[model samples]
Target: MSQFSTPLATTPGIMLVRVGQAGCALRWDAQAACWRWPDPQGGQLYAWPAQDSMPSGVRLLESAGLIACCRSGRVLLGLGKRLGSVELPAAGQSGRPLQAQVLATIDAAEARTVISDGRTDRQGNFVFGTANTGADQRPIGSFYQYSTRHGLRRLALPVVVAARSIAFSVDGARMYFADATRGDIMQCAYDAERAKVSDVRTFASVPAPAPERGAAVVDGAGMLWSVQGGALARYDADGHPRQRIELVREPVASMAFGGPDLRQLLLLGARGGLYGLPAGVAEELAPGVADTPFDDGPAAVVDSQRPHHGD
Candidate 1:
């Protein structure tokens, strides 16, 4: 559609939101009313209000919740009610480490791999996968889903070298993920209750670049959007190419859809780089997809006040 061609330009009511380093896991924290992303290089979290400017400075994530990591294991900062509290330094600052509670320990098996990408499924379970950190960077990583109710359960998906673009269809029936090294994105029927998947098949073969494969997102209409090489592209529910939006510079690291209406797409990158997103609704696109917020329901949150161990 014409609207899909350039829906990410500066139309109106949309401003460029500058963010911090290797911005991975970009998502909206409804509880805090801000856009949140992780600093992949720094191992910290940064938060910026939905309407804030660069001069306003970003707030770091300081919650008593869980942010699952690779080597460090599942971090228990506290979740549930106190989801988006900010207490770290402002933007540009490295920030200090929080008093953490480790729910699980990183064993020797994970020493050669790292949880490369992760996201919350529609039913609120954290689905993440690891990538081999070996010299050759083999695709031998496994996938797992985590929740407070069932703890952490490994998925039956194939072992990907580095799992990226972990997202889910709006209805939660379809799970989307990719390993760019393998040359295409994949999907399968996901069962939240059983923590399993079926009918795994090639969803698309978009050929995204390395490292930049850290994220992708499903819009309200159940469409899949991700960085294709250096360009941003959107695909239909059946994994057909819809629109491939080019950027002045290729995507930096990752991206996510935030904002109250869920149309505000934020593109994140390394070294505080800024990217453009949909500023206003296009006439051709009509009244927008579903007008829903990017809420993954509750997440794999843990109590932050628990005893600290296995740091």
Candidate 2:
């Protein structure tokens, strides 16, 4: 068994949006509830512990604070607060339940990885991407820029490309995302203040394609950190490789800086659970808060009443 298995006994307070293993959990529901899993036969209501098998097998997760796309076409937002048993609509034509609306829809086939770019400016502009499955699957999807007034718009890249892990500069001036299909980190300059984009370039490339959905972080030292299979890779401000350290196992797709000083490196591994490692220089991250469009709440706590793998 993996080291991650034992820690489950002591629950962490923060809620996370977990995917792969069980199923995708969403927070868009009332008080941040989740669907057990999607029905294989296309049934409306899924059982609590969805019997269907998922691709990633419960590894990828995000800090439960915003909305994300799940494996089965479900959009989830974390409540942050613990509310008793909550209920959600069986997947269907039923309109999404939330104050924020979906300005654009990147065909279900293209979108598997999604991130909230915090929020738009006074003009209401935002950026989002879909994961690149592969050429046999989907060549390269589009990175979209949406606005309440103009509606679904595309951020023209030199070519049509799909990006997995995405982040915005602290000022939200430029957008950074990874091409998991090609193993290169990329950036696009955005005059988010004016809702414009220009100057697209490859930031960095890895030795291997990042698995399903890779995770990345821009540290205070102005370095880029991304996860390959089982290692934490670092890049300079210009995207030059700095260093990489191998962790225990192949990671699914989640990373965060925790510990009292926010220095401890946290990893979410595929099939295993959460793992922690140490890095030399402790760094603080300048959070990209303004990029997010909606403020759901503090983030909902995990609902224990729901069924899953034995606790």
Model 2's lDDT to the true fold?
0.41
Off by over 4 Å in 1: 1-15, 55-96, 207-212, 278-311
Each prediction's Cα lDDT score? 0.55, 0.41
Q: How well is each residue in 39-113 modelled by candidate 2, as lDDT tens digits?
A: 111212222222143212121122222343332243333222111112344434353322322333344333433
Clash number for every model?
7, 20
Best by lDDT: 1
Question: Superposing all C-alpha atoms, what RMSD in Å does each candidate have to the true structure?
Answer: 7.9, 13.3
Encode model 1's per-residue lDDT on 72-186: one tens digit a residue: 1222222322222223444467545654434333223346765566666766566766777778877787777655555557788888777777778778888888875666788
Provide the global lDDT of candidate 1 against the true structure: 0.55
